[model samples]
Target: MGLTDTPPPHVPSWVVPASGALLITGAISWDMCYVLMSIRSHRTKSYGMPLLALALNLSWELIYAARVAEHPLERLGFLVWLLLDVPLVYTTLKNAKHEWRHSPLVAENIGAVLTAMVALGCAANYAVADWWLSAPGTGFGDKSGKWWAGREGFDCTELAFWTAGLAQLALGTGCLAMLLVRGHSGGTSYAIWFCRALGTLTGWIGSTSLLWWYWPEAHGFFVNPMGIFLMTTCLACDTAYPFTLAVVRRSERVLSDGRLVSGISVKQSAAPIVKKRL
Candidate 1:
């Protein structure tokens, strides 16, 4: 079957609007979080999003946004995300020097490193998209078969959803780790954490619902051991993040100059925690 020739799956009336709401709300919340983070980074010169996360997100938006053109609403959503990412990317690249300020060598070579990261990220995203397109049940086999014609495999949508979920989970985990290590919320805030957590929850629900409705045979992927474990881990991390921030804030002191100081005195500490603009 060709990609466009596949019949649309039968879905119940309510599932469409419910899934749409989840997906749309999740996307908008995430975009707002990124925008807020970018604004904070600009003023504080401290970028919040992890480098790997930024690269992966940018690449995912670029590739999938174009590839899903047949689905007008989904394509438009991706395009909106892509547009929002531009400013965040620019802010990250522009203020990266501050992140590497302590390491002169890294600061000097940051641009080259960022360039390489973007290139590598794009390559990785392409690889995932290719894998999805070539997977067994996506109706792209007629096209994919030209290369590896007869191999048996899993569903494309399952693989793609899993890939994106894992990437988002990793991003959230990495941000949590950074906050813990720094002992202060610099470029991160409660708002970012809250939105990210809620967004991930809704996105997960939305993706799973859509897949279940469209590809009933693939529903097992959600309840399988690996899937359950991954989802649980993501939820655990995201849910705990805000409380963690609150606990850490108890030890934080706002200085006269507006810099945030963690447990240690500013005079004795080598690095003072700069307050992120709310």
Candidate 2:
């Protein structure tokens, strides 16, 4: 909470007060999303977070915590996220084979795939961070953590726009695809979706917009066409997801092997529709 010895002259007094509140609210919501996903995965014996999305998330936390983030609070948050991902990742890998029945090659080699994805994710993160910090006009070392900008530069705000935006796209879109393929909400819940959707709204969209309002010159990119497209796509997917869940829930059937699948069972089938919903 210490102010910069030399603050950005253009920064308004209210920036911190407004942004900090949004940051805390978004942080709590995202943290709860992960915690709820972990509990749901264990209860239903299924994995949450699509496979590639899991790899991207785990590696993002690891790379940021270990190398990229400088602020002690930022590093601590990344570390906590990595720790929470452990059980969620483990359960997903353990139970993934059941869902991959149509693709034996993938089912047999998912662990290797995940390992490769994590390696790639780490490399991608490092490369992006290095490029962002090394660019001629952009590398100011995050002065905005305490101020606003450095010598009229972006102050690393673009990194979050790209990196965290990518994560949101992967998670929001991938989750819906997973639900469609599985035809059940075994590893997902309204709580998880609610927290995730709300977190992104408050954390990225709301707070970033507030910053834009105060500093248009450097922060205007957030409301431009490209940024608007990205944010709109994410919100659309999340909004559509819960309705999809509602439709899929009506005919949810339990398989003979104890896994939940979509569709009502036949008269001769051993599986039956599960009346209770999560």
Candidate 3:
């Protein structure tokens, strides 16, 4: 999303420009991460993104591209991400059963389950977007320049903040959850982890912090109790993920067909401790 309005005079000139640069950096890094996920998905015989994260992100992209997004470039970014996500979604649908074998209810009807997820995700995102855009001074129309014009909705920046934060939370936590559930790093790799961590750092934490510092009035929620919690939680999870991944990757076996055997590398793993007879 574009700034609540291009930085005003009181704010240091470098701040907005720097924020813009960080925003672009964040976007490019995330785009690269998405591509890497698709590539890793094909190689690993498992979906690249975690199920819940994928659903949340894809839903956000879908709605933002069609409804919430305003600026031409902002809309374009969401659109590109949405289009790029199609393959990732398909890959998940195709391979999800394998990942969910332990839960027959899930594995047996993954299609239905995913369908419900997208549907619910869409409804929830749409509700919030509509609420922001339609309340009194805001009322739905093209969101471009609405806030900057001193009309209403404050560029929908708050909406973008919360949604983006939610997506990051789902993804950050979902990655580790998948690792634990699958007991391996089937769709995960060091590069994927790096890009993801970097994306959040620059995307939400980095860019957000920059803008909030520059325009505290418009971006106060960046310091909201919920916002602080969301960002902190995501950072903590991402920080711990890679080390766990390293240990798990070593123990996980890979099948010849590119399938992952359960993670259990006894040979390369640490020797187990045995208790001496008491």
Please state the error at residue 200 of candidate 1 in Å.
0.4
> What is the descending lDDT order?
3, 2, 1
lDDT tens digits by residue: candidate 1, 82-125? 88877787877676675566677767776677668767877887
Candidate 1 Cα outliers beyond 4 Å, as residue runs: 1-11, 138-156, 209-216, 253-278
lDDT (10s digit) by residue, model 3, range 6-72 = 5556778787567756776777788888888888887888986877788889899889888866666
Candidates 2 and 3, the one with greater TM-score = 3
On the 0 to 100 scale, the lDDT of residue 183 in model 3 is: 70
* Candidate 1 C-alpha error for residue 7, in Å: 8.8
- The TM-score of candidate 3 is 0.87
Candidate 3 regions exceeding 4 Å error are 136-153, 265-278
Sequence-dependent TM-score of model 2: 0.85
Candidate 2 lDDT, tens digit per residue, 1-278? Answer: 11121335687887856765686677678889999998888777787799878888887778767755665566667777888888887877888787787899988888898899999999998888777666434632343443322333335455666677888889889999989878898888898999999999987788778777775555677877878888998999999999998988787876665567778444676788679978
lDDT of 1: 0.65
For model 2, the stretches where C-alpha displacement exceeds 4 angstroms are 1-10, 139-154, 255-258, 264-278
TM-score of each: 0.77, 0.85, 0.87
Using lDDT as the yardstick, the better of models 1 and 2 is 2
